[model samples]
Target: MAGVESAVPGASAGPELAVDGASNPDIDLLYDINGLTKSTPDWLDRAIGFVGEYGLLIALVVLVLWCWASVRRRPEPEVSVAGLVWAPLAAGIAVLINIPIRGFVERPRPFVDHSGLELLVDGKSDFSFVSDHATLAMALGVGLFVANRKFGLIGIALALVEGFCRVFMGVHYPTDVVGGFALGTATTLLLAPLAMALLTPVVTAVSRSRAGFLVRARRVPLPHPAVDLPEPRVADDATDTGSGRNDLAA
Candidate 1:
């Protein structure tokens, strides 16, 4: 009966064994990768940590500030105001979408649950489906780029660096960073137009108020000095005296 059961066309130990063995290479590779990562010098880890922490933050801040400044300098108040509104709105959307999605996916962070990675800094994150840092960096970069091309380029560069840093730091898998990039890019593109539309009315109102203030300021007569300054008196004799002296010398 055991031989008959084993001899069934569909029943086989071969497939089972193959399936079990399938994980071996992956496990071995994982171990090898982790071993290599573990051998990384301390300096590399420190550099990765620095870039992950300060580099991303500085890039984001600078991009936002640059956008705000550029918009503020515009002749129309709406453009500047709209830029301000959209930049922050885009960032907010990235956060709102990325956080919950990451939590729900619950993919283990690289070093925390996976054996093949080393983390530069330990994160409390429970999932590695998407990287929040990458999402935020990319979203901010795209938003800034939309606001101003030059600054946006800088933002994009920073975003790429940040995404790479996640992998280098060993807190996130490459797939996690890729997912984050996609989500962040999509979030920025989706929210940008909406943010602009939503901010239009507010920007218009602000522009109107600003125009009114300018009008009022122009209308406000400058207080004249208590007494008008007399015109400067020319010394009529000076030129004549100089000419006479020149003539005499001649």
Candidate 2:
């Protein structure tokens, strides 16, 4: 097919210009989604970019901390906090796992392969087969879910929005985000049992010692039950007999 013009105002080339071939659904979808940014105000576009890139991730971190505080107050804080701690660990590990995937796939950024894309934030020189943001967000979200259901749901929702923003920003393909989601979920879920097993003991020990405040709030001791005892019987009869004998002798 012939090349089409880029909708972006400053785009010098179109998708077809870079790769001269029939358009596939991936590029087509990329163009369609990114095209929405053309008519948006520059400030709104910037806001979206910021939220997608950094703001949401920060929010997720805060949510994780909040969850930790809540779980620590539980009767068995160590168990739940262990799961919460695994979330960041899982996210870090997932990103490391993606390093090889990105190197192996060697998929260039959408803006690089296909021109006419409105690049939101620059300095993304690495391969783009799997989105690091998506992977990290989903991993944290899933880890939160493993620790606490309500917070986990919120985390998952934030992750979905993060995926959409990556595509909208023209930084990644939809499949890249999907791959990230899959990798994150699998890593967190698959290895969760082992991670929990190792972390729980450490958390438990911390909660029992002087540093227990980190795992749980100071617990108030229960009040002891009051005990009842019988009163001793009086010796009125013996006293009365003794008094009568003294009166008769007098």
Candidate 2: what lDDT? 0.85
Give the Cα-based TM-score of candidate 1 against the true structure.
0.66
TM-score of each candidate? 0.66, 0.79
Off by over 4 Å in 2: 1-23, 220-250
Highest-scoring model, TM-score: 2
Cα lDDT tens digits, model 1, 1-250, are: 0001112233222211111232665334433443454666777678767888677868688667766756665556465456555765776788788777765666655444343355567544456667778887888888777767777788888889887777766666666777878888898888677777777777677656855332112244689779888999887898989989999999
lDDT score at residue 201, model 1, on the 0-100 scale: 74
Model 2 lDDT tens row, 58-101: 99999999999888788777878999989999999999999988
Weakest lDDT window of 10 consecutive positions for candidate 2:
11-20
